[model samples]
Target chain A: MQTLAAGPPPPVTPLVVIAIYLGLLLALALFSAKLFRGTSTDYFVASRSIGPFMLLMSVFGTTMTAFALVGSTGKAFQRGVGTYGLMASSSGLIHAACFFLIGIKLWAFGKRYGYVTQIQFFRDRYESNRLGYLLFPILVGLVIPYLLIGVLGAGKTIAGVTKGMFPETFAATGGSVPSWLTGLVICMVVLAYVFSGGSRAAAWANTFQTLVFMCMGLLAFYLISTKLGGLAKAIEAANGAHLVRTPSELEVASKAGTFTREVGVPSWMFLTYMFIPLSVGMFPHLFQHWLTARSAKSFRLTVIAHPLCIMIVWVPCVLIGLWATAAFAGGIEGTKPAALNKVIGGLPDANVGAVLSLMVKGLIGDPVVVGLVTAGILAAIMSSLDSQFLCLGTIFTNDIVLHRTGKNRFSDKQVVLIARSFVVAIVILTYLISLRGGNVFDLAVWSFSGFASLTPLVFAALYWRGATKMGAYASVVAAMGTWLYFFAQSGWGGEYTVFGGVMPVALSFGAGALAMLLVSALTPKPSQATIDKFFPKF
Target chain B: PQRLIVLLAIALAILHQDFWDSDALVFGFMPIGLFYHACYSLAAVCLWALTIKIAWPRHIEDWAEGG
Candidate 1:
């Protein structure tokens, strides 16, 4: 019954919240065992029978990951209104477009071929086992780091919110719990739910988690509004504290084509911030959601319903982030002199971190409320991690394993087992990788941008009739190589140059698309008969 | 019709940067809050129409069979 509304608790209170949340997750996992008994279709895609509302929740739940909750807000707090605003506002529109343009066509094709994974779809469409073999491994490689970030974020967030209740043994918090142990534990729990019930469990849990997360967000907004004398006053306070300042540090860094600049960025960068939405349609987990959709209509309806949820869910996060920025910046204004000094002295090095730390500390008023907020953050991370695990696992098992073997075949049971096993493996690998060290936020952007280059090949496969198998393979290789090269160079120079932080990704995607098109035209188009076989006349 | 939807989406995007200003005004059982949300919904609908009409054109079917 620990609620996050009232605030922080005594030293050991985080342990109680951790215990309760883990207990609930485990119970849900065990309960989902019934879903595991069905065939592979039942486990993976739920036999494509999911209704609209459920589908909407599933999509929303899966996408609202650690990045959506914590990373986005933290950036907003540090950088101002520019970083995530455009993305949050446009994500639903992007998703809906994907649905109308691709999801329906994908569903029609997937159902026809009994496609279970991206590789499967590619193989059918391209009519090239060799191409599938090549593409599969690359997808798995990209999926690993992307998947790792989500798992790592889940562990880090849990550790942060619970005040070190479930500490990592090796975590050098200068004496704090090591991130390794925390990551391992969180990863284990995620592995359990996914392994036990497979995709079905993930979908159901996603629905439940979505509700909990949304309610927490709404509650946070309500509390903030009421406590601060409503939205108008809060906005006024924000404005006064200069919290609405734009052209955040990232935008500035992006403009300079370097992360070396420690302060904020040029304001003009925010105006052209389209990569956020572009990345959404290209992200692996998002792509998996499209594949798992039950029907085209369900997909469209789900997208239609998604933005409303975003408006509600994100409002609190944005408000809270902004509120924290203002509250922390002003140094406990209107308070007694001694109290004001105390608040000012306790501030962290970073603005957003200081704000979050302060808010959590202030929660000392109610352990229950503290628990709920902590739960809310953990829920966000877990939702993201679970989906990432499943997506990567499916990519590897279907694309890498099955494709390489040229055994265009697997029983549903075997496929399910392979997928779950990969989930376990990925969780373990990510836990180990996260221990090596890097900023959580940095890892997220890099991981996604790393794969952003592949967008072109995907488009070619879906849209271009001239696309040839060799062309697809060539495009993926060239695009990925170029993108990776830039990513590495940026890291070496201590900044992502070329066109803001997103230039390399954009360029790579364009390069890949160009390569595919040119090669497709030069190489023979797949025979009409082959094309007919893969994409039959409706 | 498609052009109109596209125009509408562009308009909404242009306006998305500005925060909604709601001043309470009474209407039957609907609070000014609900009424405001309804207006927001209209904007959303326009955006939705823009999505289906332009981004996801119906002629996707023509391409579907070819490739």
Candidate 2:
């Protein structure tokens, strides 16, 4: 069985670094809180005070959760370089398209109407109170799993890095930090910031975390590659193991003892993966971030720079994962360094989420470097968690509590209090559910698929004046119903794809779009007043 | 100009498939398909910058700012 590296006990440097990082975030949140105007709007959307740079960082940071870092690395290890082509490049294009087409328009509406949640805009556009009621539960349902992904990833990553540090005390957990404790601490750190300063804190924290993770990702990439003999040598080793083979060629290679795993991504699956990035258009957290923008001009930097940022972050991670296969193969053949072999002695197929963490720990000798990289990974996870927690809170307060009790029924203080209470509740619930554990990448893809299915509604709401409330209803029902059915049909399996190659997102998105078009054509047009309000003549 | 940018975006999407480079390696090491995408992403960044300059819906911004 694989075990932590033998020798002297691991140092506490990584744990210390992570603690200091969390402390800095708390300090930043406290500083942001001092600047808070104490109004619900200021709390929820930062009073639209965010400028271009911060807005770019926050939106990009929030969209990239554990799904980008931990999940991508694990997936790349399981698959190959094709993993980057599947998600990163497509996301670069599609995500920017959403930011340009959907984000700006929604920001305009929110600023004009004093709206804080997506359900408010949908309710006003469709002129249906019942729609908000329907959407609130669905949006919250999807976000919970997303929150779980972050929490679970944090636990697994921290535990993986800190292995052998507490050989006697944490002997029950293989001398690593227990996931439950790590998860609880991460939850509390995130909750402290979001509870104190809301969106502004999230934005500030995201900007800082984004910078840290990017730099540290590069550092880890350089260090790991240098340790593995260099990028060219690393790639050559992986190639010799046939680690780059496509799925169709994998069986033959494996039978001939040239490949050890079916590690290639298929073509159809790659094409369909583009649909997953459309989830951004319908992300409630992203909607909240949009409303925080100071102006539509603020989005220009985001739309243009986002793809480049994705490239910078994803290339290193995907390469690191690809190199891991070579490293492991070489270790088995006695061709690798002893330290590297000690940590990653076996294929991590059973728990691929730990692959990136193991690679960092195995290949990098300096405790400080390992600590910095672990902190970077945790930053990526918590940055997204704070925004999600705050958005869910904002939705519950505005769409459910305030909408049901009547807006005039509560003072600003009471409203903020209600939002805070719900945020706390969600943080606890998500933390609890995360303990059940599932694959981070698979869970994230499933969550994004559900949101992507709902993108048609956002598109129609913004641009299509003829889109009726019934059409919106039909679109949502058809999309979510199909999503749930396929999710069940897959038996909740992470590898489940449609037609043996396509992602389930293709079917869900199609069902939703078709429902929107047919139902909108059959139903009465929206009122002229509503159309004029939403799509005013210049 | 707006129509041109939209067409260009569609073109970029199509170019993203890069199926021909699937098995080839660049620089004797890097997967050619992956390198193609790295370049493709950079191209997207340029395209989007051009879109912002030429195809942005300034009218909506004007309305929002003016209001």
Best by DockQ: 2
Best by TM-score: 2
Best by lDDT: 2
lDDT by residue (tens digit), candidate 2, A2-81? 34446677789988988898899889877888887889999999999899999999999998886576667777777778
Instruction: Identify the runs in model 1 with alpha carbons over 4 angstroms from their true place.
Output: A1-11, A162-177, A239-268, A327-329, A332-354, A363-365, A404-412, A492-503, A533-538, B1-45, B49-67
* Candidate 1 residue-wise lDDT, A1-538, digit = tens: 0112322233556557766877887788668757566676666666766667777777788777755555545554554443334456655555555555556777667665667676677776777777776766676666666666666655555455554333354335522345676677788887888887766677777777788778766765666556556666554454222243323232112222433212232333333343434555556666666656655556656656676777677645655555544443443333222242244223332323333333433523355665666677677777777777877887777677776665547776777777778877877778778788565555455565555567666667777777888788778888878877877777722235465534456667777878888888888787797676655434
For model 2 chain A, the run of ten residues with the poorest summed lDDT: A248-257
Candidate 2 regions with alpha-carbon error over 4 angstroms:
A240-245, A248-260, A327-345, A348-350, A436-441, B21-29, B65-67
Q: What is the TM-score of each candidate against the true structure?
A: 0.81, 0.94
Docking class for model 2 is medium
Per-residue lDDT, model 1, residue A255, is 20
Question: Which TM-score value belongs to model 1?
Answer: 0.81
